[model samples]
Target chain A: MYRISDQQVDFILADIKKHGIRIESLQQNLLDHICIIIEQNLEQHDDFEKFYREIIKTFYKEELKEIEEEAIFLVKSKGPFLLLSRLQFFLLLFITFIGPYITYDLVWFFNEGHGSVLPVEVWSGTMVFATFPLLVLLVLYFTPEKLDPLIPRKSKILLGIRPFIKIIPPTEKYASYQQ
Target chain B: MIYSSELIKGTLKTIVLKLLTDNKKMYGYEITQKVKELTLDRIQITEGALYPTLHALEAEGLVTIKTEFIGKRVRKYYSLSRAGKTKAKEKLNELSNFMETMISLLDIKPKTI
Candidate 1:
């Protein structure tokens, strides 16, 4: 017969609870499974720790991220909204970059191109330079390896124009954490 | 033995539900251990895989949790709800049918003339 320490049992139970598995009847079910493995390994003259590691290794042959993805998928087909919110932020980048440019262009056209040379050139040039790089960054951020081919080129170009959406926010470092 | 990953994947929910059905009440480690025992130590359940499944089942309202103090720590015990029991039966029946089909289809060996 194989024996599990109370501490080990506690660790396992804690992990299960943390993951949100609430079936108490399954508790002994898992224990029985592990007990059999340990017993077999002991019979074969393997050390307890070695046997334990082998069993764990066999069970989780895939990467941790893959396991997490499967679990998340199983739990809720519609994933957490936080990720969707991030995608929305990416979409907003496009609007921010293009909005000011369109406004500026329309104003210049209506005024018969009479805007101040220094300010107009400065503003328009700044928007162009800023938006271009910002769009590149967004593309790199959102483009998943497998889904690259699925993305429309028009969307990619629109994304490239997203950086000039607003004036770049000033950077500030908080000092609250300083001892 | 390393079974096809697909085989394990399809039956995970059924396996879990059946385990719960047998034990009545158990915690995380206990569930894994029971599966290993019943499978004759051929199948092992990992913490990485098990925790997420448990959480998913809880989220689906298939299981209910009760907490108990053990020494300095609290242990969460899991048991099937009424819905879980019904679901388990359905899943088990589905699995049994699947197994029967698989066995019938694959049990034949080719004859050498």
Candidate 2:
């Protein structure tokens, strides 16, 4: 079994930080994980740097920074989040912008003077407020993947506390990694 | 046969939580190894997914961390917090229901081991 030296441990820790892990706790988590893999797999004389490069590459598709980003994302999104389909996201938007006016119109129509006829502003408000979301929905729904990369095809929108909104790919995307 | 990662993704949290319940405490790497061993190498939890989820669990107070210094590094051992114990049961029950629903919905027959 290979033993990791203090110098090598320091080197790995620094490298983890350099690669974009800013959170001290996360850095330590990754540091211990990397060291264990190295000591368990490598022979005493194996090139540590070369082996590290290969091992680290397996952790992410693009950049190592992604781990830190993902950690922050998960923590921030933990409180309250709604994962909605595209159609549902649009519906939520529609309700947020237009639901108030319809409620007001219904309340006014039932009160006394208005009778069954809805207020003129209700129709106007609906049209004015609805157009933007409608156009947004159309653009988001009709555009190609590249054009609407923020909300890709078959993706869900995560309405969360911190990032506010994020596009989540299908569950298959999360499960794509296997060792 | 190795199950697909997609099949594992939805249940990863539950699996991790369940493992914690079964064991007194565990670290990140030990959890991965235990999962592989218990599943007979059918399921592999990637570090990329595991660390973030662990951090989130810690942040949510679902897991309590105990750190120890070994050689030149800090190793954090995670055990279920009070909330985590409750959450583990809740998650397990939820996953059990989901699995049953899928079994019925897809008309999948369970293979006898």
Candidate 3:
């Protein structure tokens, strides 16, 4: 049987969480995985550090980032409807794109006999009306509206850019000291 | 040493899955050490390499983890799932065939250069 230090356990948990894996039950599961690895290595008389490094090297390969990104994409694709924020984005886009067209049609109907409104004039006016609301909606969307204290600031920025960058902040330091 | 790395790389997953199949449960370090001892240090797997594979296997649902407490520390143990066992058997069979082919090819001697 191999014994894992609480510190190491905390580190692994933090690393897993950092990658956006949310499984409360898996905490102990991960610990068990590490302990078994360590114990088996010790049985063979390998030094602790060498054994530890080998395990880490295999798991944290450069391709892991790509694999994670693909996983996230798979999840997002499978449950497209669950992404309310993305739905909101499309809603906003629809309103921005078609809102002015409707307004222009209404204006044309009301002012039909006064004079012909040139296509260029209608387009210019529609663009002017659409730009401001679109900008406002975009600003609102991009703003850090929600504050999650558990997330690190750097990680938050990275996450905001793309789901591909699943950087999880190290929370073990705090968790270990607390325990 | 000549063909050891290639052999290890080709058979790594089968070796790991087979060990898990037989041992019932293991942890990261234990797997590496077991491989080293079993091969007499001829095929050493670094922790950096092993942990990632373990994690990947867990991700793939091939293994499940169980935790135990030992004096204020927690040790993680991994065991193969049912699916993992099936996978192990298939992979081992494939590896066996590949190895046989390679051995036969290597045994062949060119006539008169």
Which candidate leads in DockQ? Answer: 2
| Over 4 Å off, model 1 | A1-69, A78-179, B2-5, B107-113
The 10-residue segment of model 1 chain B with minimum total lDDT is B67-76
**lDDT (Cα, tens digit) per residue for candidate 2, span B1-113:** 88876677667888989999999999988999999999899899988788888988898899999999988799999999999999999999998898899899999999997
> Per-residue CA lDDT of candidate 1, range B1-113, in tens?
75653556567778888888887777777777788888887776666567667777887899998876644334567789999999999999988897788778999555584
Cα lDDT tens digits, model 2, A102-164, are 777667767846446665777788678777777776776678475656677787777767658
Candidate 3 residues A1-179, lDDT tens each? 55656675676667656654454433344445555667655654456666765664565435223334423333333211222233354464567675767677677857775565647777677677777777755554455345333333333112222342333433211111111
Instruction: Provide the TM-score of the second chain in candidate 2.
Output: 0.96
Over 4 Å off, model 3: A1-179, B1-6, B108-113
Better of 1 and 3 by DockQ: 1
**What DockQ do you compute for every candidate structure?**
0.18, 0.56, 0.15
The digit string of per-residue lDDT tens for model 3 on B42-86 reads: 788754345545665676788888876665446678899988999
Top-down TM-score ranking: 2, 1, 3
Model with the higher TM-score, candidate 1 or 2: 2
**Native-referenced TM-scores of chain A, all candidate models:** 0.37, 0.61, 0.41
The lDDT values for all models are 0.58, 0.82, 0.58
